[model samples]
Target: MVLQGMAAFRIICVVLLAALAGASTAQRPTYRAPQHTRAPLPVGATPEDFVAFANGGMQIERDRAPDDELAEHRRLVSALDGLLPQRKGMVDAYVVSIALDSDPVFGREAREAAKVLARRYDAAGRTIVLAGSDGTGPSDLPRGSPGHLALALARIAELIDKSEDGLVLYTTSHGAPIGIIYNDADQGYGAISPNRLAAVLGALGVDRRLVIVSACYSGSFVPALANADTAILTASAGDRTSFGCQSDNDWTFYGDALINHALRKAQPLAAASAEAVALVGQWEQQGRLKPSLPQVLIGDRATAWLAQLDRRTPAATTASVGRPATALLDQR
Candidate 1:
């Protein structure tokens, strides 16, 4: 009787160990965009616009003298390009890069990401808009363009008017207590307060939105974007700098790893968020850098919706494209 009991316990222990091993092994290294069973954007509906805003353009050029930041920006854009949706109504993307210098690191990545997304979703008939500053201009706006904020706001309004649904907004730059830094003045730095930004985006009524802000003090934008019904993701919490960018690199650890994993087939949004947190934590531990926290704010319904999407994803790369579950989304 004693021998039988011991044997049973041994079997249970082995089973538990195997299960733990499998779970750990199956863990993905990065964030995966939530998979949804919901149908792709409607056939005739205009596709969402992907808006990318990079605040530092000159970093790329400066790096050239000593291996500029441009290389990393370029890499980032390339990765985005490959992840772009192929069809128009599915996922249309646009990119805008702004910086103190003409070819700053941020601007370059913005352009590159835009180009890559355009190629992947070219057949979808979505338009890719690329905007940037040459640095020495007024407020860093494009030559002959309107005021900085006006032009930036106008571009967003135009995109929203053209396609009301399916939009993702990405902003990467330096941030402080107020908002993002537009320029450096002898007296002080110019920044965009989160309230002002929220109002701007709210007015556009971007019903479906993904807004990513990567910078120090980025947490400030979360409340605004969330209030405006925009799904918000921030690179760091309040008063923290988002680190990781070298010449020609695709991303700092956060953005690069997130983007790479998010696009993998049938990834759940929750899973993506969890993975992002884990990756950031690991990077900090290894490098001794201050830890940066990534946060996600999604609508209540988005959670289960993302989970269902996993079922629709092709099990393998070779799997044929299947019909989207538009009806299922409607049911939800």
Candidate 2:
């Protein structure tokens, strides 16, 4: 009897070990190298040439008049036309929402957030959206190229009263420790570094500012963008990544919680951020993922501006019924 029992126990142990090994092997990701390598462009190649090269050499022989440059110029004109007309007396908030990635998910989230803010502030002329098309044409905003973003900010500065008005800038994209990824696939590749962003804001003289960066490692932006007159919020800490960035989803985890859920209720920006953080914590815990630890830094001088904005538009407890439920998937 004892010998039989020992044999059964050994069989069970072997089965368990084999199952663990199979699970480990299944968890390992597969990688593939690119099939074709790009040829280097000539030293004096124009920006158009570079774009053509990057886009698999298709646009090299395209006509110049009806090409990318013309399209970009028309897009810029559309963006400028979308900016809110400056008001006469009371301090108003102008929002410029940008989706820095080419992904459809970022574009959708950015457009939705812009809609919420515009409705909250009654800012028909005060809101501008810069995002790539998601095929739905939510706002028909311009592509969020780096140059376009800079131009938008400069234009906004010109349209608003610098001292009295506030700028709410929201950007959503994939990020690395170095900076936020700026890629309009086939158009170009670049990054928006913390210093560069700070310089843009400073140069515009838009002192009362609210900057929300939704991306992995977005906390890196806090140090440079945070100032006495600016309030900054990030989707994750410098070392972490947030979830739910799939193309099919309506909103990301942070975007769903913060803009879709919390901010839709007309709460203060600080309060909305806190609520979003708590909600994100719950979502991560439920999914058995590590905490994203969304970060916020509201400078002392920015608090008064935020308070005034809040007073002008009181908080409503009503939730937004338009947004879809937050998904649990993660795609970086």
Candidate 3:
């Protein structure tokens, strides 16, 4: 958005390529269909429909909220403008965490993930969180939607130095072969495909980034988001289902392992990711659930920024808090 001219064109071109190529590996898993426990998923949607949606985003006619509610939502989204500019001449991390669905589980995960990431990246003033209510009283934050995500990225693009600053994005939601599903019962429904996400990041000129997507079929995003300067981690493989998405829960299987446990320490991101993957594997095995096969890819160019952020990481470890992800399994 900084240079809306050529950059917008490039984003459009990328989306076109994704639609024409239809390269997303996200598959509707055979084990369990995404349902209404946590978030409403596109139960019967196909991958082709997903690509088409990615090419031309949803134009849903959302039910109108009260005038006061609308104003409040706008105020919350506008809060992105309050984020501080990146400290010049330093390699800073700009953390953006969003809960894509209104499922209280995602909202909870996104809220904590934002804090965990902010601490790890030393992004105190550079962090922006967009999440709905976590079912714990009223929320002051705005809900995570495709539109808000774009606004957050665009604002970061304006403030951060493209070459010097890095982005750490965490998106938690339900999924389909399509992508991350955004279902707010009161608001409406939509989707964010891998290509659309890739295009937005590319258009923003944010090359150094660490993107974590937590949802079923999340691995499908890897191919589209992969870049020489990027690192990516997902909750599951293209056709797999990640567990622990109950609405009353605090974290998804991926979030509990990666953010609540591994990331609360003084360590490199790759090491934390490794530990998380192992934890998820053990959980799935014990529960006799399908393997999510969470995926992680760190490019050669990512090392520089990773090192910089690792240096900023706190030396002490934070004890894991709240309900455990395994609680979901016990309930079942």
Using Cα atoms with residue i matched to residue i, what is each candidate's TM-score against the true structure?
Answer: 0.52, 0.76, 0.84
Q: Across residues 1-332, which tens digit of lDDT does each residue of candidate 3 receive?
A: 01134443343334323222321112212222122322222455444544666544452424556884687667665778688988978889999999876656777799899998998889998898887766654457876778888888898899988887899999998776667767654355677888888888888888899999998879988998898789999999977868777666778899999999999999888899999999999999989988899999998889777888799899999888778999867856
Candidate 1 residues 102-171, lDDT tens each?
1133333444334332332221233232333212222222311113433444444455333423444555
The alpha-carbon RMSD values of the candidates against the true structure, listed in the order shown, are 20.0, 13.5, 9.3
Residue-pair clash count for candidate 3: 0
Off by over 4 Å in 1: 1-103, 115-164, 183-189, 245-250, 301-332
lDDT of each: 0.41, 0.68, 0.77
Q: What is the alpha-carbon lDDT of model 2 when measured against the actual structure?
A: 0.68
lDDT of 1 at 279: 73
Best by lDDT: 3
Candidate 1 global CA lDDT score: 0.41
Clashes of 1: 31
Candidate 2 per-residue lDDT, tens place, 3-76, comes to 13444334323322322221111111241111112221244644443333322211221223456667768877
Candidate 3: residue 228 lDDT (0-100): 79
